[model samples]
Target: MSVALEVKNTYEDFILEKDILYFRVGEHGLVSFHGKNYHIKKRLNTEEIQKMTSDSSFFKVNTDCYVNTRKIQHIGDGKVYFEVRGSESKYTTITKLRQHRLKEIVLQQKGEA
Candidate 1:
């Protein structure tokens, strides 16, 4: 079985770990998956989400956004991009300080084979 986040939204109910593209802070919290965004109703914050997805595919890219490195298409111009199947592409910013770390993580994954 695939691991999934317990946060519930008004749509499909829950988000699967592998399908998550990223999570960002909003009125509450927002989780992006498969080209769609889900508003988190629970009181959980970005920090809490980070802890739950740690050592997994998810990496906290900045203060309020956590990205699934496996879903990343490319990183450039201070932005991290992802392909959204049938929808338009999406991107989120990566902090200058954290860019190196993100690169290391992506490169490390590539070398694992």
Candidate 2:
């Protein structure tokens, strides 16, 4: 299978996509990617990072990335590009099985699903 560039491990151990909205996956957590290259660093996991969202804006876009739908610029190339709050060029890929559900969630957030 051909993985998308957005899914590449650019941040070593950190999985970064959203600049503001995020979630936890394992022993560590994602803070937020920033600056020109959208480089991200590791952060101590916090309760806030794992908080459950009951709204349409926040959902899991990938295995370790939960995003606010409003932060997305577009979805294509098996990935989700973001017009995020901090970073300039960070994106994430949804699992193939979840892609359709992601579309439904995105559209539902806009009342178009």
List candidate 1 segments past 4 Å from native: 1-10, 13-15, 26-55, 84-87
All models: lDDT? 0.68, 0.57
Candidate 2 segments whose C-alpha is farther than 4 A from its true place: 1-26, 29-46, 52-56, 84-89
lDDT of 1 at 85: 49
TM-score for each of the candidates:
0.64, 0.53
lDDT of 1 by residue, 39-84 (tens): 3434466787556557477787887677888878787778888864
Compare the candidates by TM-score and give the number of the best one.
Answer: 1
Checking candidate 1 for backbone clashes, the offending pairs are none
Candidate 1 residue 94 C-alpha distance from true site, Å: 0.7
- RMSD in Å for candidate 2, one decimal? 12.8
Score residue 93 of candidate 1 by CA lDDT: 89
RMSD of each: 6.9, 12.8
